[model samples]
Structure formats: C-alpha cells, structure tokens
Target: MPSDSDLVTVPARARTSTTTRVAKVLGLLVLAGLVISFPSLAPDSFILSVGVVIASYAVLATSWNFVGGFTGYISLGHAAYSGLGGYGTALLITRADVNPWLAMVAAGVLVAAFAVPVGIASLRVRGASFVIVSIALVLILLLVFQSWGSFTGGSNGIRLPRPFGDDVLRPEQHERFFYLHAALLAVLLLCWWAIDRSRFGMGLKAIREDEDKAQSLGVPTFTYKLVVFVISAFFTALGGGMYALWFGFLDPIFQFSILVGSYMVLMSLLGGIRSLFGPLLGAVIVGYAMEFFKAQYGDTQAHLIAMGALLAIVVLFMPDGIIPALRGLVNRFRPQAASIREVSAAELAEQRRAAEDTGGSERGEKEEVRR
Candidate 1:
C-alpha cells in the first residue's frame, strides 16, 4: 500500500534526525565543559568576576521570562521581589545568625509567598495598566525600605558577610560563586525547557497569544499566570539573595530600582524570550557590554545611555529577539521545500489546481486509449 520511495525516505529521515540529536547532545556537552572550566581558562580574577555577573544576569533574565515571556505581561517592577530577597537574606544572616545558604533558600520561599497576593492584584490588569501596577509595587518597596532605616539600616544600607568568608582568596571566591550561579542557571534552564514542552507551557502560550480566548477555551488564565509569577519571583529572589551574599552589600536603592527590572526585560527581548537559551545569550551579551562600558567610561553614567541605545535598536529591528531572527534567516536560505504551515493560501490553491489538472489530463488520456 505504501510507495517505495516513502518507505526509503522514512528510514533516511529517522537516521538523519537521530544523527542531528546526537550532534546536538555532543555540542552541549562540550559547551558545558567549557563553562565549568572557564575560571581556570580566564587570564585574571576580573574575567572570572565578570562571568559571575553574566551568570547572575542569565538567572535573573530566565526567571523574568517565566512571567514576562510566557504571559506576555511586562512587569516593570519585578526588582521588588529581588530586593525583598536581598534584604530578607541579609537580615536573616546578620540578625538571626542563619547560615547564608539557608537564608537564601528561605528568602526565595518568602518572596514566592509574597508574590501570591501581589500577583492576584497585579494579574487583574493588562498592558500599560499592569506595567504601571508593577512599577508602583517596586516604588512602594523602595520607599518602605528606604524609610524603615531603623530596621533595614536606612539610607546607609546593610553590609552582608561574604558567604565564602575571608579565608578564601578573591579569585577563589569568584570561581566558587561563578559555579554556584552557573549551577542555578542550569537548573532554571532545565525547568524552563521542561515547562516549554508541557501542557502547562501550551496553556501559558495560549494566554500570551490571547487571554480572553484562552479563558473561553477552558484554560484558567489567572491561576496559570499566578503560578508562573510566584515561580518567577522565587528564582529572581534567589538570584538577588545570591548577589547579596557574593557582593557583601545590600542597598535598597539599588536592589529595588526599576532599572534592574528593565535590564531583565531588555535582556530577554534581546535574546528572544520564547526560545530556551534566548535570555542566557542576551544576558551574556548585555552583561558583557555593560561591564565593558563601565570599565571604559569609569563612574560616568555612559553605560546607561549605551544600554538604552542597544535596547532601542533591538526593539526596532529584532523585535522577536536575536534567536528567532537568526532562525528565520537560516530557514530562508535553506534549500528545502516549504512545509504546509509555511505555504501561503494562494500557493495551496495553486497546488490544488495543478493536481486537479494533472488528474483530469490522465483521465482524458485513459479514455483516448480505451477508444
């Protein structure tokens, strides 16, 4: 019943797919090895430190994507959760004498719990209204943290003990933290990848495409958004707590700044939020650029201007992000027949007409032969 060519093609396609998968796995393994050994490969401690910063940014950006990328809700005040995490971890370590690691975990949990009520209220709005609500949340936290100086150290900020302690050399500390941050990023990436393939992810994408339609289709849009919001807060807070431990300082002004949230949004947008590695790739590029600008310009606010320009360029040109843009370019040039999905309605109509003409011609020829 099957055509001979199709039978041959099926096995060939399967083999090709298997080969491609193996190649991908091998490539990833090599990349992971390189990442793990980056500290040793780096020429100096500064490079290692930069790696830590990039890794932290990747974590934060990926965490942000859990909500921003999935639900299509742009939160401009996500730094509030991160700020809470930083303060919570620092306060626990300094005031309660808790272990730094335990404090970080606790901070994340607390932040996730705090996100529930916030998400309930914030998720009620959409578009600019949601964005405004998010920004207000951050501003409110900023004011509260700044004013409550008696407890939070006020404008002076609080000093956190380095989790690795003074016994560890600076380079070693950087190396250790780099690995810690990288490990967290890997876990988050795996979670994201898993979610991307699940029904839950499909629901999130549906909501992203059309919330009202998603709700009408029996998807619980609010619950899905809320769950993702809390999950995002947890990871984001962990990133903040880790930074607090590594940097040995917690300034509410810096922690709760809207700029931090903006960076997360920008990085995700630059890298292509829908793809698994988009944020990570964006983080590396943006983080490196920021550091390079700061190093070149010193204490001047030149890096902010540079980043703003970069963000503007990304939004204007690569709106879907770099990965998707690159993918489109690749597909455009690839020598392959277009899939049915890619075929235009006009093309499909033309194809149907051609097929019908061919069938009619064959039938006419058969009739002529019978005559």
Candidate 2:
C-alpha cells in the first residue's frame, strides 16, 4: 500500500485534452538524451559497470510493468524467472559451448514454458497473497539450486569467459556494451507502449479495477492474465541472460536474489506503476540515486538508509509517483488537461476555448492514466 500521505485518492476522469501526452513525449526525449550522454562523461570503467547493472534492472522493471504495473498482479519472484534465464544460458554455453545469443533465446523459451504452470496455478490467489506467492516461488527456486547443487552449480554458481573470451572487450566495444543496454531498454519500453494501447491492455485495466466485475462482463480474465504472465517471464529471462553475460559470471544468490526483485518493484511503484513511463523514470531515478548515494555515503550503510528514506517520502507524499505529482501540480496551475490529451497545437486552442465557454468547469480535464 502507498503511504497514507501518498495515497490521495484522485477520482478517475477522462483526459479530454493533449497537454499530458506532449509532456510524456518531451520527458522521454530528455531522458533519452541524458542516457546517451552518460558513458562519455564518465571514463571510469566502474561507472559503466554500474550502468550495465542499472540497464539490466531497467529491463526487469519494465518487464514486470506488464504484470504488476499494468495487470495489478504484483509478481515478486521476477528475479527468480530471470535467474532461470541466466543459469539456463550459462549451463548450455559452458557445457555445450553454445553461442551466447542462441543460449539466451533458449533460456527465454524454457522460462516461458515454466511460467505457464506458475500462472495457471497461481491465478487463484489475488492481491497480497498473489504477491506472497511470487516471493515463495523464489524460495522454491533457491531450494532447488541448493539441493541440486551438483547439476545446478551450487551456491558458488556458474562462470563465463567474458563475451567471446576476454574479460573486457576491445576499447572499440566500450560503447557497444552501453548500446546493447540502450537497445534492450528500447525494446522493453516499446513492448510496454504496445501492450498499454492494445485490447489486452483494456482487459488488464478492467482486471485491475475489479476482477469479478471484469469477468462478469465476459472478459477472458484467466487467459489474458496467464498469457501476460508467460510473456513477462520471457522478457525477464532475456534480461537475466544479458545481465549474466555483462558481469561475466553468475551465482544463484546473485541471480535469484530478492533484493533485485524488490528493487524492481520499488522502482516501478515509486515511479507510478500504472503509467507507461513509470518504469523508465523509476529506473533512472533509482539508478542515479544509488550512484549519488554511493558517492556520498559509500563508506557505511548510510546509502541504504538514505534510499529507504527517499522511498518512504515517495510512498507518503507522492503516492501516484513523481510523474503524477508533477502533473498534478502543473494541472492545478494551468488546468489544461483537455488541451493536452491529444497533442496538437491548434487543436489545443479549440479545446481551451471550449473549456472557457463551459465556465471552466471542465470536469473531464484531468488526464487519468489507465492501468
């Protein structure tokens, strides 16, 4: 639950204007510009290392956005599925000398297969129980890794000989690693965009609001949820595979760690889980927060403490996340919700005039984001 201060229950209304859409696009551009410029500014290989970690995390957060963000499933074992992808790729590559790219694809398929059973079985649980199941599911994987250490590589886990062989690629490939993450982030963001605008997304909104009501209206609630569950697992595994390759090693504890899963959830929730831009914003904010905190308070546990406090603030004062909070502040000043929904310069004029003509009580002017 969002902290009480953050939980201002803004009544839902249609966005009858174009301002919000334009703002979203502009925000994306700014974020893209910043991401592209970061590696060049920091020559230190370690900062780039952190970027890789953030990138991999961004993928998981975005993928989880499909289920937890959009469908309200609140999956907590996302990292477990991702670990499956990493370990699966590692075993196939180390044991059989398979191509890394091919190994990732195979891992994705296997996880998607595993996801079907989990989805079908877990759909019976809803809300908090559903979230708990996700956590419990990770434990099941941990036990498997521990008890079957002989086959699964135990607690010490798998290792990789860099990309092809060298631990570090040629200097020419420094930005290549960065671009790989940028591209992966693009793919995940695009998937989120596509999913949010589709018919399935409408079903998800319905499910999010009230499952019984949505099912009563003839929505195939179970099938859509299961399909998204499997799809989310597939992408998450792909990310995990990339992550393993990026680090040149893998451990079950590192791959399947709850902290990774928790951070993904926190990032999504802190940025506005239901919004399309939420995961991206959340990832960037948290990523940079970690960097800044590490710089300021890396000596002790102060960084973690500071991070916890910031999260609490988000939960308390900005329950809708920073985007919504900022949007609300902007809307309070301009009240241009109707003028901004569809994103046209002249069309916006007509919208503003219409609002004025109606005595400025444009009840539907607020741009309510669909989940």
Which candidate number would show the highest lDDT if scored against the true structure?
Answer: 1
Weakest 10 consecutive residues, lDDT, candidate 2?
Answer: 5-14
Would you list the C-alpha lDDT of every candidate in the order shown?
A: 0.87, 0.78
Q: How close is candidate 1 to the true structure, as a TM-score?
A: 0.88
Q: Candidates' TM-scores?
A: 0.88, 0.80
Kindly state the number of residue pairs that clash in model 2: 11
- The C-alpha stretches of model 2 lying farther than 4 A from their native spots are 1-26, 165-174, 294-313, 336-371
Count clashing pairs, candidate 1: 1
Encode model 2's per-residue lDDT on 252-318: one tens digit a residue: 7777777678778878888888887787778878887877777777758886677678767876877
| lDDT comparing candidate 1 with the true structure | 0.87
